[model samples]
Structure formats: structure tokens, C-alpha cells
Target: MKRICAWCQTSLGEVSSNIHSEQAITHGICDICLNNLFADRDIDFIPFLNSLSAPVILIDDNNTYLSANSKALDVLAKDHQFLKQKRTGDVFTCENAHLEGGCGHTNRCGGCQMLQLINDTYEGKDSFDHVPVTLFQKHGDVRHKLDLELTTEKVNGLVLMRIDSHK
Candidate 1:
């Protein structure tokens, strides 16, 4: 199998394998590409995210939201101050998040597809598109069921999670 940089299509290296008859290609970002993509952080931070049409949120390994684009803010109905450093459940107003232990620590968290997708992408250093997710959101005294499709990409040290669609 061959590992290639997804952005520049540059070959990183090849992996020895005897399982497959045909050579397969795996995608990942190279160090140079990573640096180049994030070098101009000051100017490109918000603009880069804003350029994306989907509602995108940048999250760390701990599930802390680092940043969100305008689309994401509009969808989430929250500003940067409310999202920054907040956990996924808290940001989305998940009912389980308000319980003891909070967010990922709650018993119900185990079945959360969105959290699983984020963790899987981060751990595997892979990207996933159009993954179905169902979230139980709480607002005032009502609990609402949200069906959504999510796309996640591992960008450097952050996971770019996009709300592809919602219903």
C-alpha cells in the first residue's frame, strides 16, 4: 500500500503488504503540507474556515471547540465566546452533558455517534464524510431529537467537523 498526501498528492512512502493483489493508496497529510496549510495562522484562521460552505467547527483531541466558522455559529446559534473551549455536548446542549460526570464521561455518551466519529477520526488520523448522527438536544424544558450528517477531517492537530446536513 502507498501512503500519499491528500492535499498535494505527494507520495509519503509505501507500506509492504501481501494481502492485496493491487496496490492501494492511503491518504494523509505531510509535515510540510501541514506547516504550509497552517503557517499564516493570524490572517487565515477565520477566513479559511469561513471559506468552507458547510458549518465547520475546529475541535481538539479533548473535544474542546477551538473555533467555529460563521455558518457553524449560525447553525449552533452561538458566538465564539460561547463555543471556545467548550466540550461537544455542552456546545450542542446535549441532555447527557448536564448530568453528572458530564459529556464523554456520562453513560449515555457511549452511544453517541458524533462523539465516536470525532474520536475515531482523531485516533486513526483519517477523514470521514456524510456520517449519520443523532443527538438529543435540550432547550429550556424540552428535549429535541436532531438527526444530522457529519463530515470530519483530521487537519494537523485539530479535527475539522462539518455539519453536512441536519433535520
Candidate 2:
């Protein structure tokens, strides 16, 4: 089987396989493409993120917000400083994040589709697209339900989560 870079289509190499197949191809990102996609030393971090058209946020393996694009900051109604180091639930104002255990530590988090998606992406699972997510946010005394669709891709040890649609 041949392994090829999914982004640039560069041939990585061939793997030994006992089962014969006619030029089977496996997909993966090459080092050059990965660096180009996530790390461009010439470009500023915020600017690189802002270059994307969608509302995107970069999260670490632990699901902490490392940075967010301008569109995401606007959509979330928060600044970069406020979102940095915060978890998904906290950034989205999920009601459970305010509980004793907080965010991922809460019982509700186990059933949270958003958290599950993030975890799956961080663990090197295939990227997700247009996955539906529901969040219960507490605003003063009232709790409001927010519905969202998200797409996630893992790159350079971080997950880029894009908010596809929300209401």
C-alpha cells in the first residue's frame, strides 16, 4: 500500500502488505503540509487564524482554548484574553461549567456531544463535520438552550474547531 499526503498529495512511501492489492493508497498529512497549515513562522498567530473565513478556534489536547479567530470572538461575544485557557463549556457559557465540578468534570459533560467531538479529534480520530451540539447556558436566573453545528480538524497537536451554524 502507498501512503500519500492528503493535503499535498505527496508520496510518503510504501508499506509492506501481505495481501496483494493494485496500488492501494492510504491518506495522511505530510510534515511540510502540516507545518504549512498550522505553523508559518512569518505570519502572526492571530493573523493566521483570522485568515480563515469561518469562525474558528484552536484548542489544545486538554481542550483548552489557545486562540480564536476574529469571527469566533465576535460570534462568542468575547475577547481573546477571556477565551484563552478556557474550556469549551466555559467559553460557550454552558450551565454545567458553573457547577461544582465544572465543565468536563461534571456528569453532564459525559453526554456532551461537543466535548466528545473535541476528545475524539484530540485522540487522532477522523475529523468531524457538521456535528450537532446543544448547550444549556445560564444567563442570570434563566437558562437558555443553544443549538450549534461544528466541524473539527486536528493539526499540529491542536484541534481547529469551526462553528458551522448556531441559534
Candidate 3:
């Protein structure tokens, strides 16, 4: 049978792998579907997030950055262009981000609470509010441990990672 994109019903060709196989991956959406869903108009979220006081960043399923509000930009101490093409670690200047593979590719990423929270929320497993997290941030070759509070909510098929408070 031919596989199809769950979101847009586009044919993806035959399914060679068995559902019972551990290596088999069932694709719910195609790359084109993802691109279309996250097209240029995705930035429209910025204005909406701007209405809120918290720092809000939109992330996709793979933990890739989508867009961030002005408050988020301020919190990261960077402009929109700087945040562009950057992952979570790059945006927050995580120490692991400077590692060989960077961000999600590092071994430390497996135990990352923020990543767990984002994945859980994305899978509809849980939601969080003002959850405290400790992450290492790199500055001038020195790693600083930062205590931060995070709030996450899934809205309009996108996950919103909001920086509620930092200490």
C-alpha cells in the first residue's frame, strides 16, 4: 500500500518497513507539508505573543526554533536575525551547544529537562507552568549555571515555550 501524509493526504510512496519493527518510522507528514505548515506566515505568531508580557518562543516538533516574540528577543539579548537559524541551545547559549555535535546532538541533551518538557507537551503527555529548570550557559569560556522558570503551552498546532522568570 502507498503511504500518505496524514496532514495533507499526499502520497509518500510504499511502506517497506513493518509497523512492528523498532526501526520503522511512521511519517505523519511529509517534508513539503511541514514546510507549508511552517511557511513565512508562521511569523504571524510574533504579534500575538507580543501582546503577552512573557518571553515567548515557538518551536517545532524537532525542537527547532520557529519564531520568537520581542520579549523573547530581549531575554536572549539578541535580535530576530540572530535568533534565526538557531536551535534552543544556540539561542540560550547553552554550554552543550558549543560541543562537537551541539544542542540536541550532545550526550547531555538526553537528560535535558526542557527538552523533555517540550517533547511531552508536543506529544500531549503533559503541560507545564512556571517550571524551574537549571541549564548551563556559556559566556567568555566560562559556564554559568542559570536557574530559570519555563512555561509551555501547545497552541494552534505549535508549541509555545515561554520564559516566565529567570534567576
Candidate 4:
């Protein structure tokens, strides 16, 4: 099979039989390409998901980190424990968060634009949709206010996540 790395336009050097599944899925970029690509990421560019109180970190597409809110961080941590370790692949597995039997994954935890965009992209085959998210935040014993916008864009086949905040 002929494919290009999603993060970079590098010619993958491997024959079909020379590939391993887990690390060689060819999802996007070559390991080296991703590494070089991430090296250019702003080491100080912190996108805070919260405007008040303690801060949280957001692991976007390809392990890029952004700051998040306290409550939202809790939800992501509890719901996405593997994020702290793996920090890649499909982070949100729980669907039907809006359905009756759904885990309600979309509620009050800010918007999971990454997960939702991944779903639409995968499920629709050729569609891109931004998930609509609404959340309420509470700090310790007090609830702070915020509005969040999450978005995803595919660059060279690599999904880049975006989060916007309002207070």
C-alpha cells in the first residue's frame, strides 16, 4: 500500500509485510515525522480551557497539550484516564451521551470537539461537523461561569484540535 504520513509528507519506508499493526497502522504521519512536527509546537503556547480557578490540560490530536478548566479536567481525567498515559488514539469512547441510555458524556464537561469531530469524520465517511457543547462549572463549593467551543481540522491528514473559551 502507498500512503503519506498525515503530519508530514514523508515517504513511508516499509513494505506491507514489514509493518506491525499497533505502531504501524499508517493512521497518519511516520514516527519521525510526528516527532519532528511536534518539536516545532510552541513550547509556551498554553490554551487554557478555563478562565478562572485552577487550570487543566487538554491533550489534542497527536498528543499536543492545552490548558483546561478544573471541572472539565476532572471529567476528562475520570472519563479519560488513559489520556494521562497514551495521549493518543480515540480518547472518547463513550457515545450516546445524549441518548436515553447514553453515558451523557457531553454534559457540563465542556465540549469534546475532538471526540465528536472524530465520530463525524469516521462515521460519515466524508462529513465534518462541529459538536455543540454546553457546560456548567463549579469550583470547590462555588460554580464559576464559562462557555466553550471546540473544533477539529485535518492537516495533512492529522487532526488538529481547537478549543475556545468565554467567561
lDDT of each: 0.74, 0.75, 0.71, 0.40
Which candidate tops lDDT?
A: 2
lDDT of 2: 0.75
Predicted candidate 2, C-alpha RMSD: 7.0
Per-residue CA lDDT of model 2 for 1-167, tens digit only, reads 57766567777678434321231111244567657866633334576567567798888778688888999999999998888779888899899988777789987777888889998887877657788999888988899999998888776677878888989
Tens digits of per-residue lDDT for model 1, 95-157? 898898888998888888878998998897454778898998989899899888887877666
Task: Return the lDDT, model 4, position 136.
Answer: 40
Tell me the TM-score of model 3: 0.72
- C-alpha root-mean-square deviation, each candidate: 6.5, 7.0, 11.4, 12.4
| TM-score of each model, paired residue for residue | 0.75, 0.76, 0.72, 0.31
Instruction: Give per-residue CA lDDT, model 4, range 137-156, as digits (tens).
Output: 44445554334444443433
Q: Which of candidates 3 and 4 is the stronger one according to lDDT?
A: 3
- Tell me the lDDT of model 1 at 105: 90
Predicted structure 4, TM vs. truth: 0.31
Query: How many clashing residue pairs are found in candidate 1?
Result: 0
- Weakest 10 consecutive residues, lDDT, candidate 4? 88-97
Off by over 4 Å in 1: 1-34, 37-44
Error of 4 at 87 (Å): 8.7
Model 3 CA deviation exceeding 4 Å by range: 1-43
| Model 1, position 161: C-alpha lDDT score | 83
